[model samples]
Target chain A: MNIIVCVKRIPKTAEADIFIEKDNKDIKKDNLVFALNDWDGYAVREAVLLKEKFEGEVIVLTVGPDESKEVLTRCLAMGADRAIRIEEPIPNDGRLIAETLAKVIQTGPFDLILTGVQAEDDGWGQVGVALAQILGIPHASIVTHIHIEGGKAKVRRELEGGLEELLEIKLPAVLTIQTGINEPKYVSLAAILEAEDKETKEMTLEEIGFSPREPLDATIDQVSFPPTGKRAEILKGTPDEVVGQLTEIIKRKKGS
Target chain B: MSDIFILVEHRQGKIRDITYEIFGLAESLANQQGTSFTAVLLGHDVKSFADDLSRRAPKVLVIEDENLEHFNSVLYQKTLSSLISKYQPSLLLMGHSAFGMDLAPSLSVEKDFPLVTDCIGLTFEEGKLKATRSIYGGKVNASVSLRESKGYIATLRPGIFPPKMHGEIKGRIVMEASPLEGGVDVKKFIEYIEAPITGEDITQAEILVSIGQGIGGPEHIPMFEELAIRLGGTISCSRPVVDRNWLPKERQVGISGKTVKPKIYLAIGISGAFQHVTAMQGSDTIIAINKDPRAPIFSVADYGIVDDFQNVIPILKEKISDMK
Candidate 1:
């Protein structure tokens, strides 16, 4: 019952203002704190819970530059048995990341794979599903509850419009966890100190037997704020006056 | 010939609304490329579904199988990939809903196609497909262009484009079988469980009095609840309120939560992050009140007040009570 969880290092969006860099290609990284993606925290916690129950290992993996080790280390501190960071300044392409993960994961004896439903940066919910396809295994996304029995795992997937679907997938399957799946435990300072002794492995793209695929053909042409149309009429004056005006407008619309 | 293919999505014996929205986008895209609007329907007992879709597209391709009765990405990828290779459509569109997110990623990888998910807009300029996607939630829009790829795939955000009937005439429906040796065998279907709708279901509310981080703390929630009750609407909140446990999960609106299309949306103290904006962008009338004049919610709001909601809610409540 070995579990593998994929994590990503992302800038804390809730903290500072997001500034698009001068290159317009990526964000300004200076003065920002990087941490495990919010959803991935749940994946790491879930994997650790499964490992604790089944008495197996929980391995955390990531594909990024050297700084990504912080995320893997955080996962280790949260009870993952081992941490592996693929030392590459990977592109934003989900396919490339999926390819790298698939190559590295196939070498391990893993019965399950877990990842965040989507990354906070690119917001592309592709890597987990694509990785499962590359590994030729069944996968489910937005999974809320997972129950493992004999060689199969029964999980519940959150669908649109407040509905949930249940599926029974065999072992060696991929599951992308959604938020609120569980309240991730807070990693104490002592746990971080203890994780310093645990193993943290590093791998390169070539070491994973990865031949570089053709660069992804998609490129961001331009990034800009959504245009503000001649729509919202800003009300001026004190709170009382503004509230009166708004109430009048709503009344007129309601009557119409 | 290069065609625009729309993968029709359905649940509980009814075609989802996003399928028609895809048709709306596909029809315009096909007209631009001088190709027919082609819809690919895969489901069980899809004869009536195909018939309904005939009014939307000139060609509806149907694939019916009990295995596909419920969506399995494995089965859909196997079925759609064969169809894609056979048709070689230049463009493909699907909803960014649960099913499309599950299917498109794997299918794109298997087919080696350039893929973009959760697109709000699409256009073709100089033979390149530029897809408008939201990054960092809905705060910014990035125009992504496919670089000379043979085919393109985009999963469009639902409710952004309204579906329209093309004409009075019904188009042709062509039935096809899945090419898989046997139906999806890797995963077994267990059961479909409806996520318990906690507290109240506010998704279908006509008037939504929504609050956000501006509410300060749990003690301030009753004011908004009373305001909503007075207005004969329901009380909702952004994710932060749910995170604080001020409201239940069912009352939250955002990408990870539920999408709501209300008639009159009163946003109080919400900073209007993209995650929150994407869920309620389809509302007919949006009114935002925040202390910060720079809140992004104002840009999309139909009416905005730059002031403290605490100062304004009492006045608003009084005015409404007087009018009633």
Candidate 2:
């Protein structure tokens, strides 16, 4: 069995310096530090689990500028057998990324494909479904658990009302993993050294045999930090008094 | 004449709530632009759904195929991208649901258009599309506008816009043959495993009693559960609670988890972060109980208590238990 995991490089929120570009109002990404998106980490971890259980090869793929290799390297260090970098500096939009991935996956012979439900930065949560569409395969999003046997896969999807729907799909399907699926393992020092020596296959847009059909017209016009909220007023009083005051405040606010 | 396009999302042959919400939003934008709203539907046996959508009064384009009976991004994007190019709508609106998330970016990339995902608010001015989204998780609201004008794409955050009933406005539904040839042939469906049953999902709870890092650990959850039982609500937690494995993933609420709109939300020992706030900001009433008065959760809170949750939670549970 072969499983492919789609990974994305996103700006780490802790180190991200979000500011409006002088000429554009959109959030600027000039100095933001990048890392693998949180959900994608879950996808990679799930693939590793499947690899362990099924004794299969796990391949990690990412589409971004040349710098995206950093994330692919990290995936390899985490135990993926190999990595593929779809080399392009195109905007990290989900659609473009999915399209590039679809083209790449079309050439590979994998039984199952995995991706995170959504990336932390864009939170589009559509890539897996889109890739499913592009590949013309049965796909499920927000999947919490998956079981595969004899070319049939059983998937449980998280739905509203604490309700989960069971879906039965055939082999060679795509599944977008939600967070909490599994804890991602930290890359061991030995694995990191091995990853450094592993070669990555790089593909370009032309190599994928597709071009942007039409130019997307949307752009971030401006970006700014949200205003600081009013500070909470601390009332020093007895517990009874505090409870009374809190109740009064709640009543008043509800009335308003 | 450029028009606005809205994708209608449906599952199990029924339109989702966010579909109407996006329509309501698109209607407003179309009205502001003095342009007509066009809706696109892709699925198997979508004629009935299209008929229902016509009551909303937007021009409808229905693309039906057995392959599309289930949601697939490849076929939807290929079909919708062709329609978008042919119709050339000035703006496209879709719900920020999983379906929209998958289709919008692929459409944007296919057309090489920039896209803004998960927008909470949208407006138009001087022939430009303006959208506002929560940033830094949900701490700050940032407004953005599209630079180019051939078309713009946006996915609206669910629950932000209320669905409106526009009465029956007769519209046309044009069924187009699937433009996708040989249809996606690479993958196949296998099976679905159901998630392990936890308690009720907290996002759907009308009233939620949430615990945070301050609640200590999993051992302390039962005390909050008592409060939840008294209040006729569900017990929920912030991400840290789930991170510590004190609660199941179903009970976690935040940006990465489920977005919730509860009526009465009690925050016990939760320091408000943008990620967590974005999920429950739609609550009718918010009450925060934290030892630190400086916790950000108090900013949007309707009621606040700057006290140790350990002391407050047990007392509140007792009071509610007595009231019952």
Tens-digit lDDT track of model 2 for B1-324: 477888888766678877888888788788788888888888887778888888885588888778777665666777888888788888888877656755675576557555777888898888777788765545346666565567778888876688877667888888888776645643333232333546687667877888988777678888888778777888988876875578886788875567788778888878776657867888987888887654668787877787887666666665555554
Give interface RMSD, every candidate, in order. Answer: 3.1, 5.8
Interface DockQ of each model? 0.56, 0.24
Q: Return the lDDT, model 2, position B59.
A: 82
Top-DockQ candidate index: 1
Local accuracy of candidate 2 as per-residue lDDT tens digits, A82-157? 9998876354445556777888899879999999887776455657766776676767677778888888788777
Candidate 1 residues lying further than 4 Å off, grouped into runs, are A14-16, A31-33, A235-256, B125-127, B197-207, B213-223, B226-233, B239-246, B254-264, B269-285, B290-296, B306-324
lDDT, candidate 1, A47-81, per-residue tens:
98898889889999999988888888789999999
Predicted structure with the largest TM-score when compared to the true one: 1
Estimate every model's Cα lDDT from 0 to 1. 0.83, 0.74
True contacts kept of 1: 0.73
